[model samples]
Target chain A: MTFLDFAWPSFLAPGRLWLLAVPPLLLAAYIFLARRKSKQGMRYTNTGVLQAVVPPQSQWLRHVTVGLALVSLVALALAWARPFGTDKVPRERATIVIVLDVSYSMEAVDVAPSRLAAAKQAAVDFVNQLPASYNVALVSMSGSSSGRVPPVTDHNIIVRAIEALETQPSTDVGQALEQAMAELDQAPAGEDGDPPPGLVVMLSDAAGTTNPDKSPRQAAKEMGDRGVPIYALVFGTDNGYVDIDDVRYPVPPDFSFFSDLAALTGGQAYAADDASRLADACQKVGSEIGYVEVDKEVTATAAGLGLAFAFVAAVGAVMMGARWR
Target chain B: MAQPAFASPAAAVSSVVTEPSGATIPLSRLAPEAALRRLELTIVRRLEGFLQGDHLGLLPGPGSDSSDARVYNPGQDDVRRMDWAVTARTTIPHVRDTVADRELEVWALLDATPSMNWGTGGVTKRDLGIAAIATVGFLSQQMGDRFGGLIMRPAGLRRLPARSGRTALYGLLRSMLAEPIVPDGTKGPMDLPQGVAQMARSQRRRGLRVVVSDFLTPGDAELDPAHAPAWERSLRRLAVRNQVICVETVDRHEIDFPDVGEILIRDPESDFERYVNTSDEAARLRMNAASAAQRERIRIAIRRSGCGHIQLRTDRDWVQDIARFVLAYRRVAGRLHAPPRGVSR
Candidate 1:
């Protein structure tokens, strides 16, 4: 499998980021359009019987072609804007601890789909895309910093930790980073001379429910001085409002603290208000500070001819399978 | 079909030739003026005979008027081309050249590879190509030549046989009118040196051969002075048998390599393009120098080859240059084999 094409960081301006989800969203919208049209067609009589004989893929093929076209459009758009795999970074390998906020305030609807849900999904996406050799650890950080998964070679455990996360009622942005740094200090000695430089990816809304020692900004700066970068993703805007339990809580989603953290650590700060934007933010973090050489088995065998035979068999099976059905 | 009414058989030689019948008709007897009523009439008239029509390219072209915006000169100019609107607008007198209709047998080695078609100068080199064909046709008609061009059209390389130089021109004109046409089957632009060399080897007689080309092979190490010299040598050798003329066609942007901005220029003939910045004076200078140097060597080669040469620009008055070149060649021709004085001074 030839695994690559044009590569660059795939990012879009916040205003147009919605274009990223245009494909799947449009497909779902088209399905709704079809259902609406079918409903309208049914006013003449019972229409359920007609649906049986009409081939689904024909409709699905139309949908598939539309979806394929839209996907290719996005791929081209991404290609034109430049897209890349995070694993092939220029610098040496580094350690990244994804510190996600799971505090009770994360339950606030200041950000769409709730803050905890966004953070967990974003963190999982980040871990999954990391190269296999990338030393990644997960920290379910809120009232206190607890290393849910320590830096390890395996990726599934970290992804699992991210998926099982729930909203906790407190937060300590400082303690969380400190715990992540401690975990990095203990990673096994590498074959290189210098211990892999450490970095932290802190995804949160930046509202502190607990005043742990050294504010998130202060700790992030101190880490920067130690040659570590903290890329922060602040969830909402300053004018955002949250309604939960029949109480409306206005959020001055203070990302200034997180922005300061990034500036201090010589990293980056991002804003994400939607699921797609969160995915972009995770992608950004991976691109900025991720590089690990995992052994890639690229078998360039002339299987085109062989694959044709298998494809012929598989297609026959499917066709025969359809007859049986 | 009307036949020529001759006072005497000797006077009939001066009669105008008719298309519907190859018969000659006295001028005064023509229906009013010999103007075509409809395109269909002309097409039908042409089909009536052996597709034979009076040669139009033989008529001398109007002198060159290659200007972006031509000014109005009333009695001092061609009053037929007065731009009344411009006169009304600027109050400054201006007159447009009454565009004349003429045809030219245009033979273009249109470079159709991806590069010639891809240019930063809005108009690709290929655009310049067809435009040059049209421009030559437009300009050539000032003298009254019909335009027929040879392009590597959609079908493939179809060489519209060189017939009445004027008839050849009409063929080209028809092709241009068929513009924006995607040639059905085209295995495009040939290699200049190799192609010209082959043509030179096979050509049987002395006739005018005007080559509209940029003469640069794509992706080669910056042009080796030796190659152009060699092409000129072969061309000159060909001149021994034919009246050879090379229209050195080029784009203005190609000449100066103007400091516009950064660009990626792809050579249509060879699918190789490069990111270039014209802002750097040195780079621009080098581009200009290389092009200038190659052309200079070409001039040298052509002069050495014993054939006439002229440069046609997509941006310059190509007709005037062509006219001037033709006039100059006539003068040189008049002098070279001028009957030697008995004293042989």
Candidate 2:
């Protein structure tokens, strides 16, 4: 990326930022001298000859050269402080937990065939796309949440568990998030004895009934505190419904809850009304969680830009100066 | 900063004046007086066929002033001087005796306008012109001969009454040096032409007249040598009854431009201002050519006016230039000043 668009960097030697004051001082001095020179002009006994001889010069060219020189100086001053910018790097160790909603509302056919079928297909695609080295886990949300598969490098086990999830009575998103966090806690540590980076991906149909003591929002907050972010996908449309005992109950998906949960956990939220949209959301989340951000030294890029600007300024100065002889 | 290409040794001496607009130049108190002593000075009025005798008198026989008539001698008295009325009444030739008129008056008109206030040498052009006047005053200071001065500025003309003696000459020089400097863009009815015309009108005498100036008229862009300058008509008129000498003062840098990069060139007497890049060799050459042409035009115009012209550069010693001109003038003074046979005062 170009240095301009690079993240505003952190400085290693911040005290050197004091050098930033030099360019303005230089500009002020230049302006002062230029004004004095214009005011106290060289007097000629006769200007008729000069008028006939000399053509009017492009006065702005000199200012442009000076401006370029000043910009180069500012760049060099910033580079001298030794800056660090955020760089994207692939994580060597990570644990990804997929939570599928298997509530009776997910059995609605608004997402073609059923919401559960679309969720299962998207989850399997997401698991297959992840790096083979990463450990994967699966959890089911029904009357209560439970871990179906523990964190393991074997991706087929998690995919099969996601497909086998059956619809049940209630939607307990809070319980499912708690179970995903538990699975992440049991994950194996790295060679340096630090827990692997973790991400939770949740696919749900509708809002779960309120649990007074611990809501889904509260569980998402706890998951964020444990250094894991949730990427939530809201499946099914507002017209989705389920049938029971000859009574039709409208079970439209609750997008606001998934939006709040994703926001609280520092992750993204997606709403999908069809299987294609669900698959697209799953693909985006897979790519989003694949890398990590770390501060990397970008001093050379800044220095090179400074040198390029300085070189252009010097060339301009020399061209103008040559005629001074 | 790099030194400007046009910077020279002559520019080392700054023109410092006590008056506003850089006027009120001090007298040239340097070594010109000492150096001028060895050179002979003379006004070539006699060669013009008007002053027909030696320095003591002009046409030194019977003067033109009428006196009592007397009987004409047979062979000695000329018929031209005979009183025809008296001769016819008496039927005998009678001649009118006349009183001799003698005394030479010299008037020097110095242009002290704003343009003369500039100099890159030891003295400004105004002060140098004054020095030339002082030199002329010393050269022509005689017992009966009176020396006078006229100072021309943009505002008006100042006259110093003619008087004899070294003290009066010193007084005139002091008044000239005390004249205030005219600020730039000063506008008035008076100009070089008007000033010269006034000198010709007020100072009506048959003697010598000296006009000193840089001869640059403000707002006059005419450069052709064939066309006469605005002041040439007045100068020619002044030269009609009196022998006139024009001392043209100039600065060396006016003709030879130096490489000073970019600079604003301004005219002190006019509102003309321009930025010039002297670094361009081609531009400098063009400027030099134009300036030379300009000076040449001035030289040609003065010559056409039938007056003696001498150029004095601010970069050089004024006294020396005048001395050289005078010495050379002595050799061709008679032949050069001789008017055409049909022309007479």
Candidate whose TM-score is highest: 2
Docking class of 1: incorrect
Chain A TM per prediction: 0.58, 0.80
Model 1 Cα lDDT, one tens digit per residue, B114-221: 223322222334444554454333333322223333444323444545444434554554553344433211245444555555555544432334555565444433
TM-score (0 to 1) of chain B for each candidate: 0.52, 0.79
Off by over 4 Å in 1: A1-325, B1-156, B165-168, B176-189, B201-203, B222-230, B334-345
Tens digits of per-residue lDDT, candidate 1, A1-325, equal 3558644344433344455676678778877875551121101000111122111222333444555455554554344433323434354556778888887667766556777777787888888887777778888777866888878868898888788988776678888888878878866667966667777888888667666886766777678888887888888656556565688766555677788878988988898877788889889878777653343221212123334444554554454344221
Please give the CA lDDT of all the candidate structures.
0.52, 0.78
lDDT of 2 by residue, B1-345 (tens): 222222233432443222234332344452245555556556555322233233533343456657578899989988888899998999988988764445568899998877777776656778778878988777665546688999998889988998877778888888887877777667888999999999999976667889998888665556789988899999888776677889999877766776767766666666666666767888788778877888999998887777888898776766667777888888875555555455553
TM-scores for the candidates: 0.32, 0.55
What lDDT is reached at residue A58 by model 1? 24
